[model samples]
Structures are given as C-alpha cells and as structure tokens.
Target: MDKNLIALIKILVKKSYITRTDLEVETNCSKRQITYRLEKINDLVEAKKLPPIEYGNQKEIIIKTETKNFLIEILRKSYNDKFYYFDKRERIIYLYIMLFMNLEYLSLQHFMSSLKVSRSTILNDLKDLKQELAKENIKISNSRSKGYYISGPELDIRGYMMKLVLLSLEDDHNSVVFDSIIDDYHLESFQFSKKTITELANKYKIHFVGDRLDEFIYIFIFLKARLKNHKNLTEEYLGKPNLDIISEMKEYKFTGELLSYYKDTTGFSEQEFHYITAWILAVSVGNFAEETEDKPIISEIVDRIMIRFEVLSGTHYNEGPEIFKQLYSHIRPAYYRLLFRLPIYNPLYPKIKEEYSELFLLVKETMKPLEGLFDGEIPEEEIAYLTMHFASIYSKKRDYEEVVKKNALVVCSNGIGLSAILYNELKEMFTDLNFYLPIDAVKFKDFDKPVDIIFTTEYQLHLIEQNIPIIKINPIINPRERYEIIRQVYTLLDLSVFKQPSLESIMEIIWKYATISNPTQLYSELLSFFSSSFKLKNEKKEKGYRLIDLISEDCMNLGIDAKDWEEAIRISGNSLVRKNKVTQDYVEKVVENLSPYFVITPLVALPHTRPEFGALSYSIGITVLNRPVEFGNNEKPVKYIFFLSSLDNKKHLPAMSDLLHLLNQKSFFEMLDGTKDKKAVLEYIRCYTSQSTISSSTME
Candidate 1:
C-alpha cells in the first residue's frame, strides 16, 4: 500500500467522519490527489469485500460500520505482527529505543532484523538518526569497542529518550509500540521494571488516569534499563526548599518503598528516589496532597499565574479561595511534568486551539511564570489544558431552562479541567440529559449512585457487569460520533427527539413568494436565525442579568463610617437584604470571606460567594468609605466596596466586567472618594458604564 494513502486510511479509521478540507490539510494533499486516494481506498476495500468509502454532501468522508471496523482490525493486527510496516520516522525512533536498550553488539544485521527491513534501509535510517541527534549537540558513533553508543550530555540523551517514548505512546495509545519495544529489546530488566510499577500502583492505591498506568510501565522499563547500565542521573535542578518539600511529599515515601522492593536490581539512591517521585506524582490523578494552605511554593505560583491571566485577558476575577485551591491542585502536578520534561498528550488540543484561539494564545503568553520552574518552553498540550480551566471559569453564561429527562454519568479519567470542559460541551449539546460528570474511573465501577445511562471514554461498556447502557464518547468527537451519541442516548432513554425544521424547504417556499434581493444573504441569515432559534428552544433557558439590571442609584451609599472590613461588607450590602436580593446568610459568608488580600486594588474590593449560598437574584450594592479600611495590605487600604450577589456563575460576569473597568481609571476612584452624595457617585459610574461597549467577552 502507498504510505500516504495508508496513513490517510488509518486516520479515517480513527475519525469516522472528517471534512474534505480537513482531510486535505492533514494529509497535505491536493483535492485531485484526495479524489485519487479515495478511489484507491474504494478499490482496496472492494477487493477486501468491504463497502466503499464515499464523500457525503456535507464534505464528510462516509463509510459503513463494517468497513471501518475491518480497517481498524487490520491496522491493529499490523502493529502486532513481526513484519510491521516501518515508516522512515518511526523506524528511526525504533532504532533509538533499540540502540539504548540492546546489550549485545549492534550491526547491520541487528538493525535489519529488528526493523524487518533491508540492510541498506537500516543504514539509511541510522544516518538520518545521527543527523537529527546532531541538532541537539549529540553525536552517534559506531566503535568496535563500545558498539552503537551515543555520546552527548547524558541528560540530553535521557531527555530525548523519554520524549521519544512519550511521543510513541501519544501516537499509539493502545501501547502496541511499547509492546513491540519491550518484546524485541535485549534488556533483561524490562519485565521486572514493569512488575514493580504494577505493584506500586496496586499497593499504593495510585489511580493513574486514563491509560497512564501503561505509560508508567513503558517509561520505567527503559528508565531502569538505562540505570542498570550505570547511566544514573547526575544533575539536580531544584533548590533546597523545593527538594525538601518533594522529599516530604507522600509520593516520595511511595517511591522509596518501591525502590526497596527492587533494591537487588536497582540501587536505592536519594537522588533516584526524588527523581522517580517527581515523575510518579506528575502522572497520578488526585494524589493525596496536604490540605494545608501554607505550601508557599505552589500557592505562590498559582497566584502569579492567575495574576498574569488577569493582566493579559483584561478580566478581574475574585472567585473566593475555591478557584485558587483548584488551580493549585492542577499546577502542582504540572510543575513536575515540566520540570522533568515529561510529555503529556492532550487529545483535545486541536479542538481547544481552534475554538478558544484567543484565550489559548493569551494563556500561552501569560504562562511565563510557569517556566520559572523549568528552563524549556512549555508544551502546547499543557497550555491547552490550562486554557480549558480558564474557559470553564470565564465561559459566557447563556441561560437555558434545562429539563431533566435522564440522569447520566459522564466518566472521564482525565482530571478536573478536562472533565469540566467535556461536561460543558455535553450540557450545550444535550439539554434533556442531566450529566453528573468527572467521576473518576477508579470510582465508576463501584459507584452507588443512581444513573440511567453512562457516557465514558477509554473503557469498554461490556467489560463491567453493569446493566445500565453505555455509549463511549470521545473528547474530540467527530460529527458521526456526536450524532451517534445523541441518537443512541436519546433512544435508550425513550425520549422524544426533536427534528430540526427544514431550512431548505422553508427557503424554497420563500423563493416562490419573496423578491430576489440577495437571496443568498437572506438564506444565510435565515439559516443562522433558525439554528439559533432551534437551539434556544431545546435549551429552554433564560439569559443572565447584566450590570445595568443589577446596579443603580437605589443601591448606592457613600461615606459610611465602617469600623472594619467586615463591617464595611455588611454595611454596603444593606440594600441587598432590604430588597430581598440575598439572604442574611450570603452577607455573612461574604463578611467571613473578607481579608486584606481580597481587596482587588488599593482602592476597591468586590466580595462574593457561590450563588446557592444566599443569592435570590442579581444585585450589586456600593459603599464609598469615609476613611480607608484595611481590606488588603495595611499600606493599601480599600476606599470602595462593591458587594455583589449572583444567582449563578453566568449572571455576574457583565457586572464584574463593568466594575473592573471603572476601577481601572484612577479618576473613577478619585471621583468616588471626592463625593459624599450617593447620587453623584451613582451617576458618574452610570456615565462611565454607559459609554463602555464591553459585552460578555472576558475570561479569568
């Protein structure tokens, strides 16, 4: 088979439906060549007695279920076979792994035998690998004495080795590449290393998220192999405080115990234990981290990253400490991943980049603080994951009066940000089903909660002995998979499916009666209008209140004689209680949450809690203090307090956005402090907000 065509075929097998443009762009082929390839695929399938693939009217590549399954089986089988087809790039990486692991002397015969290629082909691959290594200031040399040894900074060589292993695993999530590697290599320690990793996970109760267990096994199989050859790591990058913290972490103890079990095979050094502990913690989900707020290193890093986000995105967010704590949990693992150059594959990377392009770029730029821990450029995969967290935080809220038809469980083994992103997507797509997301895979099998259906990833439906129906969902789903999920879930639940109104038929009727003044534009507008209308009907939700709806002169107060910050919050929030916009419970929570650090700027502070605590509706009350009170630092006292209450996350963004901008101009603060009249302060704020054209466009 032609290599390019086979590659395209494999992609088609992975993604059942893709647009013609996307296919061409990914394959780097012309339209004419795509047509020829399609014809070639059809011929091959026809020879195999399978249905032919065709392009649908929507430019989607259409194939029958049987044909797709057949292609998948064939591809999987080829990866397992000894005579597996080795492309130029994979063959070179294959050579890298083999060279690193082989104890016996390497020769033309050895390379040819391992790759199942001709001697000349193996020689050419070696020449290419040498050239590529040279770019990293590494050299590959052959000597009769030390056969096929690579010479460079040993650290770079190990980093390259880890990068290759992760890259292979990323491409082949099924672990076929790793299976072949361990089986073919002459490394005697591979199986023992694999066994020790398995024991570590089971004995320590470490839940490696979503195929990460296999990744751990594969990474250490080579790592131990290198260590047995006495290629021990020589450098330590962390400072004393960080080293002390990691050594004190629970994962460090687990690493120590794991090394003890394998002490006969691998030396138990303090450096090796710390190095192993870092990577192990990097991969595990929800490792038992201390709830102590005093971890200054990770906490400071999270605060700095959030500050950067606020600067680059032009949004000020005061989400209490919960958001901070959640971000801290995520960044703790990420710090290690970057520190050790451990590659993470985000399957949702392309989708995140295309959908949240501006947010993604801003996040990438603002993540300079993260590189403080590492010397290398932060990977795009890591950035995209962070973007998802911010996207969830700053997602513009559209109110949908959602009705519950079925209680569905969304089982995603990826961490909180990814699971939250998936849940948001599902919520918009299927308004009828109430999704309780992000239940860990480790917990799903024994879950006692009532669930009508399950949508999961990476795990099969029938493997568990559950009676509830399941539909496997992809994080970055194609059109057909999306359609199948909706259709299957709805059908299983016996819910009435709403048919979309025929826009084309409606257009035909309009064409019969309407004038021909840019029918195309009219049709386009009508299609958009109808889709939005249909979407709204399905969602059945109300929009959130804006700043204008919540803030006015009636809620304004000035020159209040508050004794302290707690008193300031309650005094400013009097109108919210008088109007029944919030209960006393909400006000008390806000008062309790007030700290010197809660002050956004030296001049102003906006205080809030979760919507359910006491908020009955959207409201904002303002108080300009007569004397500055210490809501933040002692030097920077707060003169303004905006007590805000929202029904949910979406309703308060516009209000926050407006308030942030007004506080941005020092003149706004100066005017508020200058005026003792409540009406004057209210009028000035209204005038400033009236000219501002900010919509729900900001993210945290």
Candidate 2:
C-alpha cells in the first residue's frame, strides 16, 4: 500500500471527516490521486467486511464510527513492524519531545534504534537540533554517564513545550505525530478534565470561553507533569515584583481551589501556585465578577486613559458605562499579565499595526500613564488589544451615525421570503445604510420612506419617472452580482464616483503657454497634474476651511536652529503661542511630555497636550530643521515638527487624521524636503487633506 494511503487511514480513524484539501496536504498527492487511493482503501475495507468510506455533504471524507476502530487495527497490523520515516523537521520535533518529556537519561543508541537510522544520522540530527534549541536559550547537556538531555530555565522550557503542543492541536498531521510521541513515552492521561475546570470556574464566578478552558486544561496538565517529574518553576523564573493586583483577582482564589485537586496526588509548591495563577490570569477571556474591591481604581484609570486618548486622537468615545465596563474587564487581566511579566500573543498584531497605524499610536501614547502604575512599559501586543477595543467602538459609532443618515428600500416579487434574505444580505454588506422592510412589486408605489435609493429584484420602469435611482439585482446574489449592486448603489448615491477632468481641459493652458521638447514627457506630467488637480476639484470642502486657515505663514518656520528635540518642539510650539493659538504653558507641557515613543514615524514628531492646556483655538504650527535633531532615541531623529492646539478635543480630529495620513505619503515628505517656501508647502497640505477626506468619506 502507498504511504499516503496509510496516512489517510490514520487521519480518518481519528476524525469522522477530513477535508480533501487537508488530505492533499498530508499525503502530498493530487486531488485525483487522493480519490483513486480512497477507492483502493474502500476496496480493501470491504474485503474485511467493514463499512465503505465516502465523502459527506461538505466534501469531507467520512467513515462510520463503528468501522473506524477496525480500520485503525487493520492499518496498524499492515505496518508490519516497520518504523515510520520522519523528515528532517520531524526529526527535530521528535528529539525535542524526547528530551522534554524524558525524566531519565536517554542513550544515543535509543534515538538511533527508535528512528531506525544510523548513528551518524542521529548525531547529525542532534547537531541541528542543538543549533535550533540555542535560539530559544535552551541547551542540550551531555554526560558520558547520563547521555544527553535538555537544560534550560524551566519557564522557557515550558513555554517552548506549550508552543509545540499548540502547534500539534492546530495541525491534524502534527497531532498524529504527537500522539506517537505520547505512546512512546507512556505519558499519563490529563489529571484534570474539562468538567472539573468548568465546575471550578463556575464556583468562583470566573468566565472562560470554551477554547480558553481547553488552554487552561492543557496548562494544568503540563504543570502537573512537571511537578510529577520534580521540576519546579521557581520565583526567579518569573522574575517580577510582587503585585497587589494579582492578589486582588478572584482568579487567585480559583487557582488555589483548582490546584487543590492535585495537591495530595502530585504535591504543590508556592512557585507552582503562582504559575497556575499566572496561567489563569493570561487565559481567562471574559469579564470578571463586578463586585471586586478594585473596581474603583480600574474605573478611575480607565477614565483617565480614555480622556487622554480623546485628547490625543481628537475623537470622543461616548458609549458611556458599557465602554468603561468593557475596557475595565480587558485592563484587569492585562494588568496581571504586565505585573507578572507574562506575554500574551496577538495573532492580529501585524494587520492591526498596518491598518490602524494612527489609532495604534494613540493607544500606545495613552497607555504611558497607566504603564507608570506598574512601573513598566506595556508591550505592543497588549496595546494592539486595546486598539481593537477602541477601534471597534469607533467603527460602531460611525456606522450608527451613517445608518441614521442614509436609508434604502428593498423591492422583491414575494416581498417576504427572498426579500427578507436579500434585505439581510444588503444590510450586512452596506452597514452604513439603513434598510427598511421589503415591499412587493405591486405595492412598491404605495411604500414611502424618503429613501436615498430603491433596490429591487425586478426592473421597475415606472420608478424612473419618480427621480429615484432604481438598482436591479438578482434575488440570490453571488459575489460578482453583489459587487455590481454595491458599485451601482455608490454610483447612484454619488459617494464613490466623481467626474474627472478631460485631458484637453488640462493640457489646453499648459500647451498654449509652455514649449515642450518631448511631447511624451509633457503628456505624462500633464496626466499626473490632472489626476491630482481633479481629485482636489472633486473634494467637498468644509465651510470656513482652507490649509492656510489652520496654519498661517507666520507660524511656519524653515531651517529653524535648535540644539535638540526639546528646543525643536519649543520653537514650533512658540510659533503657535505667538499666533495666539496656544499659551506658553502649553509649549512647556508639550516639551515636557516628549518621548521617543511619541515619534509618529521616522523623521517626524507631533507634540501636543490636552485641549485644556491653555489653547486659545484649534490650530497647528509647522517647523522644518536644516539638520536632524536627536529625540528621546537617536534611532529616530526628528527634522519635521508639528505643534497642535485644539479648543475642543473632537473638533481637531479630522485635521490630525489628515496630517497623519499626509505624513505617511512619500510624495508629501519629498515636497517638504525639496521646498522651503511656505506657500508651496501649504498648497500641498491643502490638496492632500482635501483629497484624503473625499477618499475616506467615499470608502464609508
């Protein structure tokens, strides 16, 4: 039999259904080859009088539960006492598991025999394994008498082992390999079950999701195994100062109660208790009991952070008590993690950093004061979680406001069955639009809701006379149809689409006035000009607004002489004060709060304080230095400075967001560097801000 067929039989015995894609990955076979092999396996199964395997409705391979055990037994017998061949990566994993799980010294002959490989091959694998372990600060120690074993700080070893276990759980193929390791080592079954953990959680009123509960159980099992092996995670392994927050958590009591189950069985230590408490702190995912004594401090700190966040981002979070409660819940666990120096992994960190760059920075800055409470800095991973919380609230608020502003009516033939489905689909797709109850085609004329557009399954010729744009869509919309409908909706509502200037209109004046040596180069430049100019032309300008209105020539300084970042900040802030936009005290406050963390990105610094800090009006001041000045960290030196002052926290948000967006653009910085004239810089700012607003609004 093919090795791929054997692998498939193993996976099928373990799971009722496995995806064809997963089978393809495991067997390294094409889809057609998998089908052919499944047929051959079924032929063999029938010969043994077992049920035939087939694909279920979801296109996953299915085998009856009664037949799975027989199939597994037959496959094991067919192995004929041959050891499975492991690839290089698999060899490393096998070695790590052996060293990590084995309490007794492992002999070189043991690995060679178990792997069915020669001694030199095993030695080469061990050499590669040692290099891999060194990256994690783990070492493989050898003694002539005791053979080889892994030696590391117990916490690091546990962390690495946990990662390996998690990897196994995520990949079915890896789980199969991991099971073999468990069998080889004769590892004990998990001491604590899910029911016991759930019961303990309920008794203490600690809420954990199903996945978190699984994680806690795994952690408990690992801790028990380590204790049974007489390997303890010491206080020095944790290396964190004693925090009052850990003691205050109700999870501390829950941890003590849960571990009492293993106390007489495996024995426990103070370090073991703290280790379990830290795991609980890290894994618990829901709100804690509301009656805790530290609620006041949590609430106070949340309030202060939100206020500072509002001032820094110029956006208000006014969801009231619910927002406060949610933030408080997240902050509590986060506080424990920071206090104990435990790391929380956020898989979405990269995407969050890329998409919500401004909000991420704002959350990081707002967290500075809270960090002082623990006398340590919060990692970016923790801040990303906070960013998600705030960003979620902000998105909901924006969608709510937009829904109130725009309404749409759906018309269908039956107006009940398919209409309801279509209405729900459209509502989910266009969250900013409020969708009303569907109306039958016959009653469409009588329905009135002052809607912005009419979406119908069938074309309505009469609705054309009513001056309302009618969009025709299929009752069951596919992806392409849905996209077409959305594009039509936006086009009809004049949100995303705008008229572009004609090429002739743009080139007429330039061609009439200037002589061109190369028409190709001239046309390229003209096309670029028309693109930028027309984008600005189509932008909806706010009343009483212009770039010069925010930052005047008097407040703009070029080649400013400054000794350091502090002086640089003061010079720009003094410009704002001189223009009567802010007070001198605001400059001092801004300078005092300057930190390397506040560097928005490379080569730019935005220094500002709360709106209440002596601001006369909402304004910005710009300063460009001839040379870079070292900020808090020399790694990110500053040459461009923006001093912001706002009369109201929320009013300056648009400008601040626009400024940040502009800074992200390479061309904007190129223009700033190439020119020292204030007017040219102001024009670039004006055009970029206007274009950004239009683009942002259109996206909504």
Candidate 3:
C-alpha cells in the first residue's frame, strides 16, 4: 500500500470528519493526489472485509464507527511493518523516541540496522537530530570508544521527553508506531500496576481527570526504569520541603501506600517518597480528603490573594461571596500543585499571558506567601488559572455606569497651531473624554455651560473660581506635561458610564418605530444598528487606552548610574515613589523580595512587590542603565528595569500586555539603544502603542 494511503486512513479513522483540503494540506499533495490516495484506502478497506469510508457532499471524508474501529485495530497490529518506509519527519520521530528511551549507548550501525537504511541516510538523520536537540540545549555526545549518547541538563531532557509524549498522544497517526516501539523494548513495565495506582487513588478519593491517569502511569514506569538503571534524582533536584502538614491526611496515607508497592522492587528512598508526594500534591486531587477543618486555611489564603489583588488593581471583589467560594475551591487544589512542583497544561496560557499579563504577574506576586509553604516557586500555568478566577470576579463587579465619559474645554493663549496640537494630543490620551475645539483663553469665562474639566496653557483664576478643575499644560505637550494632564483628567473625571443598551431595548425601540406591517424588516434594521453601534463603541474604547498613555517622561530614566542590580532597581523604583505612584516602603519591600528576582528577558528585569506594599496607583517606571548590571547567580544580567507599582492588578493588564509585545520585538532594544533623550524614546513608544491599538481594534 502507498504510504500516503496509509497516512490518510490513519487520519480518517481518528477524526470523524476531515476536509479533503485538510488532507491535501497535511499530505502536501494536490487534490488529484488526495483522490488517488482515497481510492487506494477504499480498496484496502474492501480487501480487509471492512466497510469503506466515503467523501460527503461537503468534501469531508466521513468514516463510520465500525470502519474506524477496525482500521485502528488493523493499524495497531501491523504498524511496525507499515513503518518501514517512513518519510523524513517520521524518521526523525523514530530517532527521537530511540534516543529518549534508550538506556545505553547507540551506534551509527545500530540505527542503520533498526531503520534498515543506508549509513549515509542514518548519518543524515543523526545530523538532523543533533540540530533539533541543540535547539533544546540537548547534545548528542559522540565518543570514538563508548559510542553516541544524549547529554543535557536533566530538566531540559525531561521537558523535551514530556513534550514528545504529549505530541505522540495528540497525533494519533504516529501513536501506534510509538506504542509498538514501547512494547518491543518492554518499556511499559512499572513497579506498580495501573490498576493498583487507580485503586489507591480511588480509595483515597483523589480527584484526577482520566487523561491524567495515563500521566501517572507513565511517570511511575519512567521512574522504575530510572531506578533500575541507578539514575537517581539528587536531593537538590527533589526539593520538596516539609510534608509534615499533610502527614495525617488521607492523601498522604494514600501516597504512602502507593510508595509501599514500589519499595521492595525499587528500594524507594525518603527522597523518592518526597518526589512522589510532590506529584500526588501537584495532581488535581480535591479537598485534602475532605478535611473541612482545613477549609479556613485555604479560605485565609484566598482572602489574602483577593485583598492584594484589590489593592494592586484599585478594584474590589470583597462584596462577592461567590468570588470567595470560587477562589477557595481553586486555591485548595492549586496549593497541592504548587507544593509538588507539578505544572498543569493550560491551552489558554498564551492568550492569558497576552491579554492579562499584569493580572497574571499580580497573582504570581500574591501567591508568593504560599511559596514558603511549597518551598518552590509557583508555575506560570497555575498562575494563569488563578488570574482567570480573579479576572472573573473583577469583570462581574465592574460597574459600566462608573466609567462615564466626560466633556472637556481646551483653552489656549497661544496661536491655533499649538491649540490644535494640544487638542489632538489630549483627545488621544483621554479616550473617554470629549473635547471642544480650542477656544482663546480670553473666551474661557464666556463658554461655561458646565464642563467636567478645563485644560488651559496657563491656570486661570476665573476657571478656578467657577469650581471647575483647571489643568495647566505646556502648549507643545511634552511627555511630562502629557502625563500630568492625563493624571489630572483621571482624578477629576467620574470615569463611569451607563451600560450599553441591550438587545431587548433595541427590540422595544424597533417595535415603537415600526408600522406593524413590516415587522421582519424593522427587526433586521434594529439588529444591524445595535451591532454596528456596539462594535464602534468597543473599537473606540480599545484604541483609546494606549500603552504610552500609562508612561511619562518623568518616570523614565535613560542613563542611570548603578553599580549593581539593587541600585538599578532602587533607582527605577524611587522614580515611582517620587511621583507618588508608590511609597518608599514599597521600594524597600521590592528590594527585600529580590532573592528570586523576576528576570523578564536577558536584557530586561521587572522588580516589584505586592500592591499593598505601599503602591498608591497603577504605574510603571522605566530605567535604562548606562551599562548592564548583574542581579545574582542563576539570573540574567539586566540593562532595562521596569518597576511596576499597580493600584489594582486588573486595570494595568492591557498596558503590561502591550509592554510584553513591544519587548518581544527584535528592534525594541535597538530602538532603546539608539536614543538617550526621553522625548524621542517616548515618541517611539507612543507610535508603537498607537499602531498596536489600531491593529488590535481592527482584529476585534
């Protein structure tokens, strides 16, 4: 049978309905080639005395239940034979599995014999493998006497193995081939059977999803293999601390029982037991075996997190009991995951990081207290989930009516050129503000029908006498003046508005306007109008909040003289304190908590503490050093320091997301290096934020 036909059959069996186009794309073949492969697959199915799959009207290849099952079984039994003539990608996968699973040295001849390929072909595959492994910091160490073997940091190797296993699970087409290799090598052997582990888990009432059971099984099997080969993880590698708290818990007892099964076979050490304890804690087990007495402990932690989040974001979720309950439930499970160093796989990890970066960071900071309990840092995956919980409560508590749009009057003593520039700049900075065209400062007194605030080139006594807030700004609107204007506007404005009208309101309006003779037409028009209006409002709001809107020239330092990371951090943080964004104590607290410094990138560092550590507002201070400074061992050297002082964790997330996006760009450092003037750098940032805001709005 043709290899393409075999691959196509494998796909159709796994998927209920796959488009012909998808098949063409995956196979890198033309539609005509797909048709030929499909015909071959149908012929094979007929020969095997099985019902054939057919292409539906929509050009989706549909496989019946029986046909899929039969094909899966047949493929499983004969996978090795069909795997002989493999493509380049398939060949690489096989090599990956061999290197990952093999305990001893592998020679060029060994691969040649196993693959039944020429020496040059095997050598080329090794070369490709070497390149791929290098990307992950894993290298194939070739010894003239000992043979070829894989070597790298243990963590990196295990991470790559986990990724490979996950890929195999996801790609069902290659799973059979991978399984065959596992079985042939007797690599599936475990000290404790899957049944024994499952029974123990159920006996203790541990809550793990079905898929996670496979993870547990494979983990134990791998552990057994490592023990047999005397490849023990060091005490430092198994850095789980103080399992005494859960010593009396049912889950702990269950883990003990599970370990007992492997004690005789593997000679499990205390370190090994501690390692298993971490895994047990990290897995999604519910309620600490229903210890209702411990509920307060979890609730207390949740309360602290919520309070810190509220302070950082300048928002409150204290009034919501549902929020507390939800957080309490999540934190209990998360506590174990953190304690065990088990990182869950969140599919929304990237999106969450992009959209709610500040909130995510806040959650990470809030959970720092728990790190002492776990004796390790909480993984980003767990932090992402916690961010979602807090975000949910924040969104629910947010009052749309509180975000009222404000009207402003701009007064300029200078010519129309300065006034027009100021008007446009203010409009861009304050998205929620509606500004009247610039009027002469002399006309300021005559104009007032009661505007929320007045922006003038000079503070006027008459405007102040009217009891309206008067903000003084330079006519040219430099970065510092712009930041002050924004701060003043935010302080003066109500910052809340009524929620947008609902569909029901639109329907009622349509009913009121319609003649009753054309109900369908009226409904259509009303729906279109409401949708377009809603879309416009959302776009305007999104484009209004630029990243540069949160930054000011006063808080930005281009050439800071710092001998060490501490000095650099202090310099960056003190800028925020001077601006009253945070207090001196906040800076001190940040420095004190600098043991495990948050190195954002090789060139950048973000040093921050909890919002309640004396942060007065949501602000970020940037400091670029004259030269790079070393933080400590295991930390990257830093030049750019972003000191974040958030009033509330939620509000500054969009700005944080924008910053991350900017930092990810290759030219970000280049642009920073090219400028020492605060205004020039601010302009570059402003332009970037403006472009990003527009692009995101368009995408939405």
Best of the candidates, lDDT = 1
**Whole-model Cα lDDT of every candidate shown, in order:** 0.68, 0.64, 0.62
Best by TM-score: 1
Among all windows of 10 consecutive residues in model 1, the one with the lowest summed lDDT is 456-465
- The sequence of per-residue lDDT tens digits that candidate 2 reaches over residues 361-394 is 6688678777776657888988877876775555
Q: Order candidates by TM-score, high to low.
A: 1, 2, 3
| lDDT ranking of the models | 1, 2, 3
| Local error of candidate 2 at residue 607 (angstroms) | 8.3
User: Cα deviation in Å at residue 117, candidate 1?
Assistant: 4.1
- Model 1 over residues 155-189: C-alpha lDDT tens digits? 57766777776666666354555666677764434
- Candidate 3 Cα outliers beyond 4 Å, as residue runs: 1-3, 10-18, 25-28, 46-105, 113-118, 135-137, 173-178, 187-192, 238-240, 243-256, 259-266, 286-289, 292-305, 318-688, 691-700
Specify the poorest-scoring 10-residue window by lDDT in model 3: 395-404
Clashing pairs in 1: 400-541, 401-540, 401-541, 596-631, 596-632
Instruction: Quickly count the clashes in candidate 1.
Output: 5
* TM-score of every model versus the real structure: 0.64, 0.55, 0.53
Output the TM-score of candidate 1. 0.64
Tens digits of per-residue lDDT for model 3 on 1-700? 4566666766565332255644665677777887877777778778878878777322446666566666666565556564557667667766766676545777888777766789999889889988988998899887876577777765466556655554555344244445545565677443336788878877876755324555566656655555555545564465444445555456667777875675443465655565565566555434423654346677778777776554333344445676666566567766756554444565445655555556665567667666777666777877877766665555412112334367788886533433554565465555566677788665566785558887765443345456566676543333323333443455456444323443334455655676567644654465455434433233343332346767888899887779888889888888888899999999999888774336655677777777777989777788988899888565578888877876653456566657767877878778777778889888888888778742232001
